[model samples]
Target chain A: MYCVETDHLTYRFARNEPVVRNVHLQVPQGSIYGFLGQNGAGKTTTLRLILGLLKKQQGIITIFGKSFEEHRLQILREIGSLIESPSLYGHLTAVENLTIYQKIHQAPKNRIQEVLELVGLSGTGKKKAGQFSLGMKQRLGLAIALINKPSLLILDEPTNGLDPNGIIEMRELLKQLQREQGITILISSHLLAEIEKLVTHVGIINQGQLIFQGTLPELMSRREQSAGIVLNTSDSQRTMGVLEQLHLGGAVESSGVVLPFVQKEIVANIARELVRSDIAIYGIQQRTDDLETIFMNAIK
Target chain B: MHLLNIFQSEWLKRRRSLASWLVVIGGLFTPVIIFTMRMVYHQRLSLPQKFQLPDFWQVSWNQSWESMALFMLPMGIIMATGLMTQLEYKNNAWKQLHTTPQRMATIFCMKLLIILIMLVQVFVVFNAGLYLFGILPSLLLSSVSYPAADLPVAMIMQWNINFFLDCLPIVGLQYALGLHFKNFLVPFGAGFLLWIVSMSGLTWEYNYILPYSYTMLDYLVLAGRKIRIGTDIHVMSVMYFAVFIVGGYAVYIWKNEKG
Candidate 1:
């Protein structure tokens, strides 16, 4: 069974404007699903809906083989989440903040220290959380989510405000958690480059709609097919007219006219056709396929 | 089991809050102020030879209860409720708490329960201070011309319990306001303004309708006579208590589920 599944899920904060439109999501069990979107792309809203933090406006949400509405508390007990920013008590110390959740979840006292050390906050002794730096607060939030030993963890931009080293540490820590505990994680990020290395599956969202949802290899294949040739011509408008006459299709870009790299012969044919048309050719180069390019294209 | 865990968590969250300190100071304020006023009055004016000092114990109890009902209880309840709810909103902790396995109803009830417990502590401390500082000091002044009656332990206990019951509606009102509004100033300002309005409510014809007036109406000091409690006032106090408690809990649960 999928760790999380939502069918025709939709949400709108105001009238006539849905923040999360009709969308279907599938997260395979034990896989790190990277939810990719730009800022204000309904990433956080979707996570909140999945975690039952926000009331689902329309559609079905199923987690661990049961309906979320029918078994909300049971599903929530197995899921841990950190949405937007860390929700912490600034007046309390790191350990104290964790202790409150520990008592609520009925976890043992020792679990607080264990999660603290796991999040690399073992040294924040007696310092109020308000005094903590942004990175430390993020760790503390992660630690709270981990304190319950949930099977599924949903984090919305968990590495949002971290420095380079802090970002790397968070990436490694998430990877380690999935490996060691076999936990299924649904982590959202606006930057594909940031989470590409950690996600086994990817779902892309744009303007409240699911643009792409598939395995990493499936996404990579799309990128492979997207590889094209960039040709710089003296008369971009005239070259476009000539290419249309020859049944060739391409788009004008700042670098040049870009056409699909269907075959090596096509590149030669285009070069010869442009020469015969007397359209001055400046340069020709092949563009490589990567996740970043695929993500940009998919969103666009 | 989950309910107990929630209660325990709520308690721990409030262990170091400013509301607890405010409650402590609020509880002691009335008695200490009354005691100092009596001391200064005795020091300043010499009485006529035939005039006997008013019943000192009665005077102390009346002043303390009046001060408590008029200012201390309203302000304390407002500040305490605001402070407790502020901790949740300060860092958006309400969102975090809602994501847990615990039900929102349970969480809301547990928080309200904690506030009630804190108010109870304030009540107990206020009474304790009244007896310790207000009554004991008067007895020690051998040269004073007041009547020497043994401390009316039963009367004092009755007054404390009555005032506590009378203040329940305010507790409910403040808790509802605090949870409904995230900003501290809204609830605090509302409570302050309501307290001022409640002062006029005591003399109004429909005083029973106002929750804030319940404390003043329940016990009264008329023309320097000993404080009196009427049967109608007791009945009205119970009704106000029941209405506000039930109303507040309904508002809390409705808002939680609707969100």
Candidate 2:
């Protein structure tokens, strides 16, 4: 069953354009769903709507096999989230902060120590959360989210403002939550590289609309639809002419004849012709697509 | 049980906050001055005046309640409610709190309950401070004799209850403003503005109409200043408090964006 689902979710400010338009999210259970979007792309809005922080204007949100509207408290009890900034009281210490949530959630007092240790904030005794570094604060937020041992976790830009080491640490922690604790996480970030390392599923939102949603492999497979096959041979001009004669148009650049890549069979055919034409084949290379390129193309 | 949990959480949020300081400071402000001034002018007060009955407890209670009811009670209520209600917004934790498993109504009521409890705490401290002012002077000055009469427990408690009742409407109004606005200054500013209005209308015939004026009017009526409504002011104070507190809750619950 999907851990969280939204159907035709649409929200707009009064007398303004839609901030979140027609978003249908299907986050599978036990998967790290990366919610990718640029700043103000409604990623936060969508998360808020699903958490019932923002009243639904037009949509249906279901969490843990129950309707969010009808069973908001029940759904919320099993979910944990940190939207926008890390919502923390600067005056309280790390344990004090988590204790507040613990009492409210009625979780065991020991869970506070467990989450603090899990977040590597065990040594931060009596230091107010306001004095914490940005990375520390982010971890503290994660600790609070895990205080109740939630089944589903939603985090907005969890790796934001973190150094490389902090990012990796956070990524590993999220992976541990999903793998060891069997928690489902939906983490939103503008950095695909950040999310790419940990997300099992992916959703891309642009201009307040969800443009792409699928598994990581499904997103990776989209690259095959367009790639350039470069053939470097002893006689590049001859290879281009022969390719043009074959009606498989090719452009001859300084590298060689660049052919439009379609499939393995097409590449095999080109190699077979190159050998028949007596052109000494030096190398054949296909340009790979990066995630940024895929993300940009998806938005377009 | 959940209410207690929320209450504990709410109190934790207030730890080391200015609202907590305001309670202690506001509660002690008048009594401290009363104690200090009496100690400084001990020679002059050695001879009791015509108003001094056998028991000086009444005098001490009057002096304590005089400034408190006229100014500090309402102002303290305004400031405390404003500070307590704006805790989430100030910390940027409203969204975090809103996402918790608790219902919105429960959150609203628990926060209100915390603020009200703080108000009670301030009264507790102030009452202690007044008692100190009452008994401490007899020990220091040789000319001043300890009162022959026992501490008028019933009268003191009655006055405490009445004064608390008088200040409820201010709490309600300020709490409403506190919920509606994110800035502490908005509620603080609006409260001060209403306070000025209440002060100006002190001698007016219909001063009772203003909920903010109840504290002062109750004080004035007790101090022998004639006002139109000599009836019980607690009822009026309570009625206004009910309206404002319920109105604040409705505004809070019905809000589209809780954070």
Candidate 3:
């Protein structure tokens, strides 16, 4: 069963302008669903709607096989979220801040120490939250979300404004949570590269619409449809002529000769024809589009 | 149990806040200032045998209550409410709080309750300060004796209770303003302006409609008699409290949940 499902979800800040329009999301249980969208693409707004932070004007949201409106409290109890910036009491110490949430969640007192250690903030004794660095603040936010041991975690732009090392740490932490705890995570990011290695499934959104949703491999398969071949020959003009005789048309460019990549057997046939014609083969390579290129094309 | 947990959590959030300190200091301001001024006035009149101290306990109570009702209490309510709500806006914590499993009404009510608790603490501390200052000065002055026989404990308690009830409408209105505006200056300025207008030389009938004037109207000393209770003023105060508290919570829940 899907952990989170939204059907024709719609939202608007003003009367006439709809920020999210008929957007459907399918997040499988126990999968890291990466929500990809450009800035101002309604990714955060959609997350807010699913979390029940904003009232839904249209469509239905179901979580854990229950409608959002019917079981809001129960669903929310099982969910953890970090939206935009970390919500913290800057005047309070790191431990004090976590203690506040722990009391609210009615978790064990020891859970505060556990989450602080999990987020690598145990050593930050007596340091006020406001004095924490950006990366530290993000980690604390994640720690707060994990304090309840929630079944589902929703993080919007969690790695935004973090240094490279901080990003890697956050990525590893998320992976560990999914692998060890079997927790389902729904994370949103505009940079595909940031979440590419961590997410098992992806949903690309554009202009308040879900453009694509599927497994990582299914998204990668799109690149195969647009794949092509490149050959670096000793003699380009002669290679094009030899290809025409074989009923294969190609184009010669600065890199080499370009042709539509069809199958593995076609490469062998092209090689045999070039060797037979005494055109010394310098090199040949097949190129498939990367995920970033595929994402760009899909959004466009 | 759930509401208690929420209240405990809300208290923890402000355990170390500067607002708590400000409330203590603001509460002491009126009583301490009036006590010191009265001490100096008595010292200046030491030579005049004809200038006897006017009922010492009544004078002290009147001075403390007037300063508090006219200026300090209104400003304290405004500051307390502003400080309580500013924490949410400063850290953008409303979004975080809203997404929790707790009902929005529970959260809103818990916060308002905490603010009320803080105001009560201030009121108690201010009375304690007034009593201490009033007693110490009377012991030192030869001409002015503590009116222990004239001022009964029940009378003081009754006066404190009445003043607290009269301030409820101000609490509700300030809290509503604090929740509605993200900028502290706007609510603070509104409270200051309204307070000044309430204290101006407007018609006595205007006090019936103004929440800030309730405290001043509830108790008055005229012609050597203490008018400690006004039934009409108490009724109006209760009505204003119900309106603002219910209306403020409704608006808060609606805006936070939907807007």
Q: Which prediction has the highest TM-score against the true structure?
A: 2
True contacts kept of each: 0.64, 0.90, 0.71
lDDT of 2 by residue, B24-58 (tens): 99889988898798888876766334124565777
The candidate that wins on DockQ is: 2
TM-score of 1: 0.87
- Taking candidate 3, what TM-score does its chain B reach relative to the real chain B? 0.84
Predicted complex 3: CAPRI docking category: acceptable
Model 3 reaches an interface RMSD of: 2.0
What's the lDDT for residue A2 in model 3?
98
Clashing pairs in 2: none
> What tens-digit string does per-residue lDDT give for candidate 3 at B78-154?
88889999989887888788777898788878888898898889878887887777666667777766544355467
Please give the distance, in angstroms, between residue A126's alpha carbon in candidate 1 and its true position after superposition. Answer: 0.8
Clashing pairs in 3: none
lDDT of 1 by residue, B45-156 (tens): 4322112444556656776777687777877888898899888888789878987888767887788889989989998888788777755444656545434555667877
Most accurate candidate by lDDT = 2
Clashing pairs in 1: none
